[model samples]
Target: MIFESSETSGFPVATPRAVPPSGRRPGWNKVPEVTVYFWTIKILCTTVGDTAADLLKEKAGLGLTGVSVLMSTVLAVVLAAQFRSTQYRAGVYWPTVALVSVVGTLAGDNLIDATGVTVETASSVFVIALAIVFVVWYRRERTLSIHSIDTTSRESFYWLAVLFAFALGTAAGDLVSQRLHLGYWLSAVLFGLAIAAVGLAHFQLDLDAVWSFWTVYILTRPLGASIGDYLSRPSGDGGLELGTVVTSALFLMVIVGLVVYLAATRVDVTDPEHTSRHVA
Candidate 1:
């Protein structure tokens, strides 16, 4: 298993984080339904993204730029398929997410390692970029709900926001966990606590579901990255010394298993039509 904790890692919780959501969003599209299965696979994807990026860059002898270019190309091809599809297909959607996660990790990594950018600077830049994406998205679509991402423009915005969240999470996670010297396991715990607090606010305090969902989504990227490092880094580095290939393979296996199940069961597929609203 990935962890000894109550929850393994982070991702968007079941739809909206509300106790009893009155009006569900209408229609499904190119994404999985928000459910336990969805989060499980999503978390795995993040962890694998972290480890797989390492394997590609460090182990496979693909330099940072090489891995970035390679994965970006793959992500572009997959995204084209995803955008072309009118409906959600686990086969297409999850691979795109996995690729995006890897590429996102590389994006943040290149900023710090290739250039001389500080994690703090990269983190701040990503935050501003993400905010701009949201602003443009909300202005054009009038809603920020993932459930409403049926149209092409909205889907584009959704993917862009997702990419930024992963990139920002990568920078922020590295800053707190690595630059701050908290170490991997500690960083994982801290980020997990933050995510848990968000969960509490959403369920108990009536925090807006859409905001809470996105908050969790953005936060999980780092939490999973931390967990990945904790598992894969050398024991001399205060990690389990599992190795990048091992960690990546293990998490990838779990993700594939869960995705296959969800594909067959369709448990995470959303309704064709319901009523939901995001940031107003």
Candidate 2:
């Protein structure tokens, strides 16, 4: 199997990596290739995550704690299946992401709505937690590039960082929109602009790709959350009033359709033409 590592490639950095001479791993990278489709499906998953949390709480009467428990169980099962797979499988990977998005949303909610922690305080807490995860991950692995996720430990760190990103996004989104009254559409626009600036910096101003990727990843969560709220919330609340169920169903269907296409085409697989390139 091909082992994609950044020991001698991709955005330059000062840290050293431990790529083997062969650069081939006993197992392939368990994560999907980063592509436009990946980002599209990610935003859809986030939107569904935001709306589904509302549905589970209000429609299903699970409350914040109950939905948290239920989704956490589901996330655990899906993540176990993810860890068992040796290669990137859309069937397993995207489902785990979708479940993670939901659980992450609920986690942020429980901290604020249940524990009376202000969104600002909660957001700050998650920021510190995420920073600690990154420090620990990089200290151990000497690399934070997702392209290097060919080992179980690297994959574990990747998912942990992802969960923290989602939670942080939720708290920050609420703090700005719900607590500060920026409104959903405006919040989405602001985040969209921020991501665009990041892209510009990475491409034109010499920003680091690894940092750019992580920054954009975290920003996408709030963008998706804002979009979901704008579509599902009532007109009285300045939303389009589409309702949570409809919003969730629409995004979920789109995500499923895209995943099916991705699985069939394998278009997102990294370099099918040279899957055996040696790591330098």
Candidate 3:
């Protein structure tokens, strides 16, 4: 994978071209460029996923099973639209990500609460599952870079990896905060530092760009979840007591505004030239 240092994130940004198998014409890339906005919206979606799930279960009184079914159904519909679209549309893409976040969080919760699985076991299982997805994806396509996510097969692998990342992140966050008793704010700090360390390793220590990107991506899930918890949990619980409803609404509004801006501007579309460059 070809990369250049990102001005915003300090980590290497992928600029690889995708080569479709012979006899296939390449299509428009189905995901955004790895711009600052991409990371911003991603973290926002993760935070929303963490709190919105709780809000639905408690305020809407849907309970865990009901919320899981409702959100999973919604995510399936959104993902269907995502798969059908010829290219990335901020409206369709971000909402699909947000829904996946919700479903992923619920999946982790069910595994722990209803099934009586320990957090460590759940985390380990998700890690193994994610590794398998990555192995299969890389073996088939010969690359794990998100820059090449143009075809349906690659897109399927991308979403599968994303789902497992979210699930693993939720389990890891819960394990640290609840089991280890680190509290929400401290957990957020820990994960944030972890992301920074990943960046430092990539930029200063010559880490592989693809591995660096995926590491930061997985770490962001727990970081955003911890931030959500820190903001929404009561003061006695070492939070600001903003409440999940307030936190979800506030973040959702910001996310909507940014998505609208991106839709109008088309600033996040992956450049076709970058793909061609890699192929050449």
Q: Give each model's whole-structure lDDT.
A: 0.80, 0.82, 0.86
Residue pairs in candidate 1 whose N, alpha carbon or C atoms collide under 3 angstroms: 24-275, 26-274
Compute the lDDT for candidate 3.
Answer: 0.86
* TM-score of candidate 1 on Cα atoms, chains taken together: 0.88
Worst 10 residues of 2 by lDDT: 7-16
Per residue, candidate 3 scores C-alpha lDDT tens digits across 1-280 of: 4544333333455544444555333437788777789888899999999999999999778889999999999999999999999888999999999999999999999999989999999999899999999999989887776766777888999999999999999998888887778888888889999998988888789888888988888999999999999999999999999999999999999999999999999888766765565553
lDDT of 2 by residue, 1-280 (tens): 2223233332222222345423435337676677778789888988998999999999778778878999999999999999898778898999999999998899899989999999999999899999999999988877776655667787899999999999999998888786668888999999999989987887698677678778888899999999999999999998999999999999999999999999999776655323334233
Q: Candidate 1, which ten residues in sequence have the lowest lDDT sum?
A: 1-10
List model 1 lDDT by residue over 7-28, tens digit each: 1123343333222223323464
- Candidates sorted on TM-score, descending: 3, 2, 1
For TM-score, the strongest prediction is 3
Clashes of 2: 0
Which of candidates 1 and 2 is the stronger one according to TM-score? 2
Candidate 1: misplaced stretches above 4 Å? 1-26, 275-280
**What TM-score against the true fold does each predicted structure earn?**
0.88, 0.90, 0.93
